[model samples]
Target: MSTTLSPLIDLQLKGFKVYEKNLTLQEAERPLLAAQIFSRRDYYKVLLLESKCVLHYAHQRLELDGGQYLFFTNPHIPYSLELRTDRLHAYACLFTEEFVAAARSESLHQSPLFRIGSTPLFKLPASQADYVRGIFHKMLAEQQGDYPFKGDLIRTYVQLLIHEALHLQPADPVVQPNNAATRLTSLFLELLERLFPIELPTQQLTLKTPQDFADRLAVHVNHLNKAVKQVTGKPTSAHIAGRILDEAKALLQHTDWSVASIATCLGFEYPTYFNNFFKKHTGVTPLSLRRKD
Candidate 1:
């Protein structure tokens, strides 16, 4: 069975939460734990896992042997965790952007450690892991207290955690070929995935065409198109159209936003253009799809 964890709902209920688990009990005494799949969230997460597990994050998969590792994720990326051993011990802190407002230098989502395509996993040395564990213990203890300024104190702890991870060396870069097609294709995909989950109706997609993406990737349009096609077996325009179509369908089905609003947010200059595009690709109008739903 699979489970979808939504931190947005949790953060709406409580701006912040911290928890820990130690699953070292004997097999007969242990409780069943299912793999957790989480979609994009509007909050940030900091996790320390001391277990053997496979982490599927965005477009990358990481197999972590039994050891302490610090992981950071922001609102844009989705990830899942599958435990490989019964000796799972972990601590996690989840908080909305407002929870750390006082401590942030800029949007946490834009930070290098949490930004898309940047490495967020760091293997911790024993000494650093012990220090990190102590910080989590403090967070847990203070979370139960009645101090009026505890919220401020907790924010400091969260900032400290970010600082600690920033000081540590990140894991070796995932090995990929130096070939231009492979590298360009990987960068193109990451750039494409970054502009997603359009959480607010006021938010608008800035890069809407293959040329737009190619410009941002700093290669000629033809170069990007050729490389993407060579590596992914599809033209760049096809991929862009496919992603936009997926997001359009998702918004039409899951959201109450009007067609005009959806069109504007999706970078369409006019609703008529959006209507034609959607119908041409899906053989149904956006409104029809919503009404059918």
Candidate 2:
């Protein structure tokens, strides 16, 4: 069954305050939030559960029965839960992308930490659970203090947890090396798709080039370009231009915004630039496209 998790605002109102920086750790409490459909939050989520439950993420589901376990959810994926046990005792820790920025790691989408489109649940043995619980306790204890380095310490603890997870089930280096190229390409396309539909007349895409995405993914431009071409049979820049042109056509046809306004929204420095770009890509100018529409 689909369930809607609480929003960040609702969670904050219910005592999930930011303990330090962009991180917040919330203990399960009374009058539990209702289970609905999928819930999307703009931060990373880690839940250490003490009860059995079924979690639905994207097209897949995981059934956990008793024992301590760790489940991870990144900002990109929306998930829901169905509590199999009446008593739901869990500790949820949330942190934004910027909070853990200092740690140089793979993009969550391509990282083995959570895997894509699925909620990763790692069953903790009794001994391991005790150790993991201690980490959570330390975070909780640190919450009571005003130490300036509190955020840094918590980020380190989170990193510890990630390392532990990796240790438990390390990715196969041999297989991954072969698959990494395709995976990176796919992840890039997914990231590109996220900034779409131009919901408003003012929404501008910050990632306008292959280099921007390469920087974000922590990969060199050549590697990213090669992977994209190998997988999609097109150059990296072509995909970007195609998407921008698609967005431009959609905007011109649907919105009454002027050409200049549309140009700015599509990341063009000037209307003349957008006009030339549109013409180069579509054999017609933005105004011409709008007239046809």
Clashes of 2: 4
Task: Write one digit per residue (lDDT tens) for candidate 2, span 150-192.
Answer: 6777777788777777777746522332588778976887677
Put down candidate 1 lDDT per residue, 59-122, tens digits, no spaces: 5679999799999987666565667876678888888888788788798766777877766998
Worst 10-residue stretch by lDDT in candidate 1? Answer: 28-37
* Clash count, one per candidate: 0, 4
Off by over 4 Å in 2: 1-40, 105-110, 115-119, 173-293
**Candidate 1 TM-score over all chains jointly:** 0.60
Please give the distance, in angstroms, between residue 281's alpha carbon in candidate 1 and its true position after superposition.
Answer: 21
